[model samples]
Target: MSLKVECQKEELAEALQLASTASRSNSPKFALKSLRLGAESGLITVLGCDGEMWVERDLACEVIESGGVLVDAKFITSLVSAMPSGQVALELLVEDGMRVQQGSAEYKVLSSDPQDFPEPPDFGGEGELTLKFSQLQDALDSVLYAVTTDPHRAILTGVQVSYDGATLKLVATDTHRLAVRTIAQEGMGSSLSVVIPDRALRAIRSLPVGADDDVTIRFGMGRLGVEAGGARVVAQMLSGAYPNWERVVPSEFSRTWQVERDQLIDSLKRAMIIASESANRVKFSGSGDSLVLTAKSEELGEAKEEIPMIADNGQIEVAFNGRYVLDCIQQIRGPGIRFELTESTRPGVIRPAEDGDDYFCVIMPMSLT
Candidate 1:
């Protein structure tokens, strides 16, 4: 027996985009595979993955006949995404494969053994609290930059998620810098800690955006499962405990400065133009009501800029990687930002002055040798 399905072009396109990241080989697997047709609910389960990440989408389909089969995810997705935006029909072919038809265009794609595909990791229990899609996405976007790509330290490779009933905090650090973001949730729940893979978080960002409903995140056993929009994602959680980041963040600072976000970012960019390759160092000197940014390179020329700042403490000077400081500033969402420093050698904290349950970035000072 054969099966037929009709779905919107956009839905298929988005699903393909999310699945493309999961392809394991040089010739990427199809974006749609492991299709299971359910006669009772009129929903078709579409599964795709490479090995590390897996995504599943359930689409409402008019099943002319009740049956199921596996097809290449890449072929189906490419064919559907390239087709004009309209209804597309997928028919099971007798040759142990499937045929996709859109208007005058029709293509046949080979099938993979569905039973060979790895099963998605089971997410045992419901999450502690559900969060809005926008909130989660925004928080991730604000802090993902600080996640370490360095493989030497495994803990810094992923984002640390901490939840304590009232607030959910996501933190990532690379030793040189750290980014911490907090968001408010509705329900009260027990405290939970989980380190989610950076690749999985990036995959979540690619999922259909602007979803009104809350996304369900389940952390149990060694896996984290996220269900949002009409799709679901399952990934293995990073093993081992994250570092004691709180201790690394300085508690008090000798000097605190508040400056415009754009101005600081612009000055850093200009200074970085001539910064040394070995150490993208930029100097920051605080005075009465202004801060000076200076960078000099042996090969290139030196550049300096003076920007007005709201200095509350005594004058101080610190050196840091301009790229790291600019990365933290770019993640900030507001007009004015606060920078608290303890000494020229200690780490400094950068956070928004207004209390809106946002993000905080901490940067370690570099020694000038």
Candidate 2:
């Protein structure tokens, strides 16, 4: 069909950008690299999909003809972003081409039949969960970094979402480390859980929804759907059993060291300078009223820094991946951090000095040698 519409350049660009998240520019199939734009009732909806994931956004526009067209996602997004200014008009100038015009500049881009694009499945009706967009974003930030990048372990590449009556928890683990964040959600006593890919959560976090906007979440046909403002993000859910993160989290620790978050972060960064040359292993040992961070590299020399901390159970020595510890502390918003450990070999637990039991990270230890 043909789509004739005029919308602000910024809005068009943003819509295309959202859709481009799922569009595969390098895909061999043209439809997988293309996004469809439909004009109807003073609105232009842009949709893009790569078979598994899809993103759709609606923009208020002047619709002259009710129709649809498919165009290259990357080219269209960049083209609209570079438009001179103000409004950009889109219409079928040829049998198989789209004309984009802004000010005196104009370009006719090749278009494909909208029918060639796979339409996203319909996801409507009341959702199982509803929460503020900011709440979901905050929870996502705390755990996404821990999600595994390994494609082979599809389950570990996703965040485990579980809700039970009063609280919603998000858990992620890459086998080396685990991150968990819980939020207070009133009502809804039923318990449910789902594993959503990290990529999909990242796309949802990128949506330009208001901080106070309400986001609706729905699931169907083994797919998870998130909707907020005029945008919708949907993706296929991962299969197989997720690791029991609860088991990885230490139930009790014999020693706990309370230290300043910023100070430890700085110390780790400096130690990593040398530690990076040695598999990022940084030794943590007791030193009176403070803790010493030491990393030695035959080629890069050694780094040693001491930070004030109170450790219980006399003396403790442990070695961990410096980068892994840094990742956990960066997610801590509080000024203080607590490191809980039973021994050098067991996985150490880290939690913010504040927030009670709301957030924590469990990191596997490295060999001290």
User: Any idea what lDDT model 1 has?
Assistant: 0.76
Q: Which digits, one per residue and each the tens of the lDDT, describe model 2 over residues 80-166? A: 988766988999865749999888888889988899988777654333667788887888999999999998888999999888878
Report the alpha-carbon TM-score of model 1 versus the true structure: 0.81
Give per-residue CA lDDT, model 1, range 28-86, as digits (tens).
44323333222215666676675656877777766676666566555666777788888
Among residues 3 or more apart in sequence or in different chains, the pairs in candidate 2 whose N, CA or C atoms overlap within 3 Å are: none
The C-alpha local distance difference test score for the whole of candidate 2 amounts to 0.88
Q: Extract clashing residue pairs from model 1.
A: 30-72, 30-73, 30-74, 31-73, 31-74, 32-73
User: How far is each candidate from the true structure, as Cα RMSD in Å?
Assistant: 3.9, 2.5
Highest-scoring model, TM-score: 2
Worst 10 residues of 1 by lDDT: 31-40
Once fitted onto the true fold, the runs of candidate 1 whose alpha carbons sit more than 4 angstroms away are 1-7, 25-44, 50-52, 61-111, 184-188, 209-212, 273-279, 297-300, 356-358
Error of 2 at 364 (Å): 0.8
Scored against the true structure, residue 107 in model 1 reaches a CA lDDT of: 82
